[model samples]
Target chain A: MPVFGFYKLYLSSDRKYVKKLKNLLGFIPGNLSLYRMAFRHKSIATNVKKGVKNSNERLEFLGDAVLGSVVAEVLFKLYPYKDEGFLTELRSKIVSRVNLNALARKMGFEQLIEYDNRMVSNTRQGSLLGDAFEALIGAVYLDKGYEFTKDFLINHIIKSHIDIHKLEQTETNFKSKLIEWCQRHGKDVSFDLVENQEGESNKLFSVHAIIDGEVMGLGKEFSKKNAEKLSAEKACEALGI
Target chain B: MPVFGFYKLYLSSDRKYVKKLKNLLGFIPGNLSLYRMAFRHKSIATNVKKGVKNSNERLEFLGDAVLGSVVAEVLFKLYPYKDEGFLTELRSKIVSRVNLNALARKMGFEQLIEYDNRMVSNTRQGSLLGDAFEALIGAVYLDKGYEFTKDFLINHIIKSHIDIHKLEQTETNFKSKLIEWCQRHGKDVSFDLVENQEGESNKLFSVHAIIDGEVMGLGKEFSKKNAEKLSAEKACEALGI
Candidate 1:
């Protein structure tokens, strides 16, 4: 009863967070502290008690899992015939850091985050918005439960941002595709690193894709892998095999 | 009405599977077909329509995510004081391929799996059992929903096998620990590969841990990382810092 009383008092005290959450989630939170904690980044974490972390890290972890599960479920249903690999790739596309950062910006998630770190003001630096986005899911799961979290994601996020058709058309790795095509056609393919030069903080690499002892495509990029991919894409188009 | 009629007819046809599931899951499945799909491994998968894969792989992916979310929630509540890294490490230990394989055997999960692959008979050959274990969790989530799935995992699995204290004592990586300890004590430590010899199909790597420019400990293993870990353990014991 005492705990319940405290929770009630806590909920009543935070009308601002409650209003924000209601606008974002379209539901009143059962426990307000969980949502507040979700917004609280580790940079501003105070009162470091012994072994406990008084920040959003744990919640972010939990939210990441929850978000994955919900997305997997939706994808499982949406693409009933798609193989595991396709499902996985699509899920990754949906939850990719770049996509999440853009989604967070579109949803005004940065405005709600409680971070004291100066580095995070840049917005595009690492997984700031994405982490907060996931932490928000965790808070929703804690406040309302799994079904509600799934519903919140579906109604609020997935229907708006995730375009399944567009993602399928988007090329992920041309090198892998080219290799698979070669294997299926019984053709030998190899990628040779043609050049490597020092860049600002990385190495600029040039690669050439050789198909059946012929240099079919050439590419230059910051990483050897990317260069190979670009070369493979060119090779895939030029060879048309 | 037609779909409901077909569902009832389908449920009636699989009395044996239903009975077996009740014995295993402690509840009658709302949808037995999902559980049936959970056991359907890719090797024996039939009716491979265009984009559809009639195997447990997709279910396995979904189940893995669901299982992780539930486990994360449990760990979060159980270890209220533990940090995110600690929680992630413990979760990895619990859901690791080896541990999952062992748990699957303990729960007789392999007995029900439908795999036509010759390699799976080895039991410890790879992640076969663990994959099935995850697929089973996915089936449970689909059939009984998240709440029931969580209860099943907590009541049937975690309560029986997952000992938090024992896990905390489990040495994950001696090398990482030694490096951390060295850093804390302001001492320089490095692990170098001292030798490489040909073994069955791989090279046996010998590594030595050098502390303050002195060879403190030596180790040999199949992998450089493992060899480093072994050497680090020895160095930790020898230095006793």
Candidate 2:
């Protein structure tokens, strides 16, 4: 670093904080307070005015949109011929709370986030990192600009960490999702082998996904497992679950 | 337009369309095909390939994200001290299907949209204009880029049209509005007091809006009246009332 720049960094009381953020985000935040507010959980934030607190919630809202737009643009270019349904589904998978929570963990966001440990439960604690990850994006957006933020998200976040093709595989895992959905709705669901077409190597297995004694979907595939999965996918589509 | 630009417009096969778009949007389109696709509804669209149609749906999806990001930034700046919930509510009002439909009608979008009149119902027909409006934004984003689109949205769509303060005024008396909606739908509605957080102030009132025996919204405030109003507003927003 230049002598003057280092001197400025050295003289600041928040030198450690700025350095830590720079090390983590690969950019020195221009407005330090934005970054500070991004990591602060509401539990530890005192009421500022008009029932508003200096919490990361507002930043999360902003960052969510920024991240979504970036991801949407990337997917739109990457899958030019794909339909809206495909784009929407892929976008949701990439931005789901569960997926983001995992990303935050992998990116070491837990080290930066400030939350009251006693107030937040174990499950709620998991979301704190995800919220902070989004808030960080918001901070970057404000400190820089939309173009810079887009570049940062595309180069630093999406290209560096996410495996899009691998993530797409999760889209086809309909059977487990169907089971989970059924469990949530308190409905009994079952997949039963309906028939087999042909007898030799060209044989196709048929399965039916039934819920509450009614057949929700029927599918035919080369293997029993795949037939069940396809049936479950059809059922999921029918139920919009 | 300059003489050369006029010559290009006059000689083009879609001169009328190009002229109409230029008049309506206040700028000439760089990519005419994108604008055409933006107004093409799915009911009239031929399947391109693999269940994909050259309709406005994909563009609408892209535009939704772009519009959301722009609005979020605007709200973030305009209401620096506002909470996420307030920002979210205001943003939704600005981008709601009902609002967009009205805007489209006022801005002469109905003539541009191409839908199979026989296929779309009355309510669906109303939203078609809104869909096209978003798709048009998507076209602008793709053709002129994000900065241009943002400028266009702020200057032409938002500032020239919407009254933000007036909209905020309309957000009042949501409790009465929610009750009216419930009554019209023949559903039972009530505001119930939920337990205040254990560590929170004793004066805090947490209210839940219950509709048809299901919890629809929760809101916290210092007074029960405000809490109930907030809860009802949340429920109304949730129901898209």
Candidate 3:
């Protein structure tokens, strides 16, 4: 703590909230209202002006962009030889809602989110936490500024919580990942066996990832499962998931 | 020009390119190769290493994120009373490919972009200009850092070229815009006139914007054209375009 931090914390009305935020983010917030608003879900928010609520939705939009830019920069520098398709996929893996929800849960975001449980479903509640996580980044960006938010995201969040190296090495679940991506985007994905060539080995299997009724990717391998996996991987690359 | 800039320009092999870039962007680039890569279309690029080439795609991806973040921040502050949906729509309008293409043309991006005309059709060439615009932003970002790039975007680009207030007030021709958006996404969008209400205004019409066979937005207005426009606008809002 700074020399005057304890004195200010003792007198502040929302000292507990400030302390918790400080403890979590490793920085004192400039605008406390932004931080509060970051956790205030639409379920509990009152309309502020012109039908715009003092909810975290706006913050989520801003934070999403901020997070995307930071992640893009990180991936761009980390993988100097990789193409945009690879960088985009790795960034998506890092910022996907499922990954974010897990990160939020691990970071105790549950304590800060202010959504009405009755209005939000049990399944939707997890997203509320992820929403708040993005909103928190928005709050930090607005409160401190872009450079500060970048530092916080890099030093405090990405460096400590994320493993970019490990993420790159783990390419085993492309089929499931592609399916989940399709589900999230309200699209349908299916793997279909393509007809084998007349002269090809009988043991070799051919598969295609049919997403939204279009063949997004094709793969041929010895095993059916491997073919499916390879096709899904190719689909992910094509879809930039 | 700054001190020694004229001297350096005299000795530089690509002094004309440097001068052209400076004239367009209102700043001298620090890293010249990054700027060169920004304009190098994949159609003209040779292999650099692995599958990656000296193309603009990676930089475009990075610049896309950077531009989104900068635009998000700008809109967030500009429209304090607006919802995220509104901000998102406005941001898309500014960053849309059509807008960027027009902007790039106005700024003489055609002269800078290096592409094989035989390989790229006339229709495809416009998007290449837009891609180079984005990649140029990425070059600026990499050369001058985020703060400097942000300042360049805001001061040199957005402030001088864009009219936010005018864009907000001018909400005409949304139907065509929506159709263009759908075409860009390879989705089908149709405006169907639903049944008119009995005993309502004689000219009243009801329309729904059906996207991918799903009713995304509905609107009721005095005229069929107005109804279609309103529905399209609502669909744009719904799609966050």
Which one is best on DockQ? 1
Regions more than 4 Å wrong, model 1? A1-13, A117-126, A172-241, B1-13, B117-126, B173-241
What DockQ do you compute for every candidate structure? 0.32, 0.25, 0.29
For candidate 1, the docking band is: acceptable
The 0-to-1 C-alpha lDDT of every candidate, in the order given, reads 0.78, 0.85, 0.85
Candidate number of the best TM-score: 3
Runs with alpha carbons beyond 4 Å of true place in candidate 2:
A1-12, A171-241, B1-10, B172-241
Candidates ranked, most accurate by lDDT first: 2, 3, 1
Q: Measured by TM-score, how close is model 1 to the native structure?
A: 0.71
What tens digits encode model 2's per-residue C-alpha lDDT throughout B96-128?
Answer: 876888899999998899999899876368789
Put down candidate 1 lDDT per residue, B26-99, tens digits, no spaces.
78876666787888877777866985667889899899989999989999888888888988888887887657
Per-residue lDDT, model 1, residue B145, is: 91
lDDT of 3 by residue, B56-129 (tens): 99999899999999999999988888998899889987887767888888888888899999998755777888
TM-score for each prediction? Answer: 0.71, 0.72, 0.73
- lDDT string for model 1 (A60-158, tens) is 888988999999999988888888898898898788765776787778877788887774544234467777888888889987899989998998888
Question: lDDT (0-100) at residue A210 of candidate 3?
Answer: 89
Residue A120 lDDT in model 3?
82
